[model samples]
Target: MVKQVRAARTRQALVRAAAEVFAADGYAMASLPSISRRAGVSAGALHFHFASKDFLAREVEDAAADLVQKMAGEARSSSGTVLESLVGTTCRLLVAMAADPVVRAGFRLGSDPSRKNGPGVLAWWRTWVHERVAEAREAGELADDVSPEGAAAAIAAATVGFEVLGGADRDWLCEERAAQFWAFVLPRLAAFPQQAMATVTGAGGVR
Candidate 1:
């Protein structure tokens, strides 16, 4: 039992450290030695837990997937119209990626060309945006000119773009910056000016 506990703690540390490394450096650039050192564990211990760097990356990706799934779930479940949910979901995600290293790394790994055999996080986010926009269109929230596919594409692109930009300047992920995005997008996409602006400038925000 003690050995199991120790192993579990060690594994968690390795995952966190690996995430830090992967988040800072792309998967191709990240190294096992750096990860082990970040975890404060010897190379032998890292090997004991992960057979290779690929395996370690997979673990980091998995952890990131779990975090993203939870974030998306919360945004979906949050009380609001599809439009509001869309806005809130996006804001939350930007904030999360900015604040959380593991969340940031998961997105990086998911986008990395080397990781095959699994659906990527960015793909999953795009799908979510597509579905939400469809719901908004059905509810008569979207402008007649705003096709669901087009709106989804724009939002998905901007959201991912923010991730890329925020890596260098974290201000891109802040609520105020995200609010600016909503301010720009809502005008073009929302059918009702009052309702759309209300959602964007809402005190409860993303409600």
Candidate 2:
């Protein structure tokens, strides 16, 4: 039992270290030795926990997906209109991603050619967004013409674009920037009625 607990702790420490290394250096540039050093463990230990760099990267992606899904679930449960729920869910996701080194690294990894189309992570994100958009549409918060799949895709793409553009240069302002990004999206996505538009614009404090 003690051995199992120690192994679990060691594995977690390695994951946290890898997250930091990947966030700072990008997945392609990050090395096992560096991650081990950051975790205060030997390279052999890291290898023991994860057989390969790809395995470690996939673990990071899974961790990020779990975190994102939890946030999405919580947002869905909160009180709000469908558009509000969508925007709120997205905002929470961005905030979590901004705060988590693993999530940031996973996002970078998902976009990189070397790690593209690995499994589950990006697809899960797309599906989550699509589900939320559909829910919003059904609730009369979104226009009838709005394509739930397309809008979800757009939100996912825009969120990624902002993250890439902001990069490490503007890490401090990620949440603020994420809010601004969603503000731009809310108006276009809400039902086209003047009252709906007004509510959205007013809620976001947009002029």
Clash number by candidate, in order: 0, 0
Compose the digit string of candidate 1's lDDT tens values, residues 1-207: 999999999999999999888888888889999999999999999999999988888787778778877877787787467788887777888888888888788788877776664646777778878988998999998999988998999999998888889888988876666778888889889998678778666433354
Give the winner by TM-score: 1
lDDT of each structure?
A: 0.82, 0.72
Worst 10 residues of 2 by lDDT: 198-207
Give the poorly placed runs of model 2, Cα more than 4 Å off: 116-119, 171-173, 192-207
Pick the lDDT winner: 1
Please write out the lDDT profile of model 2 over residues 1-207, one tens digit for every residue.
Answer: 999998999999988888888777787898999999999988888999999988888888888888877777776677356666566666665666667787777777777776655644666777777887888787777876778888888987877776576565555325556556666666667785554434234323222
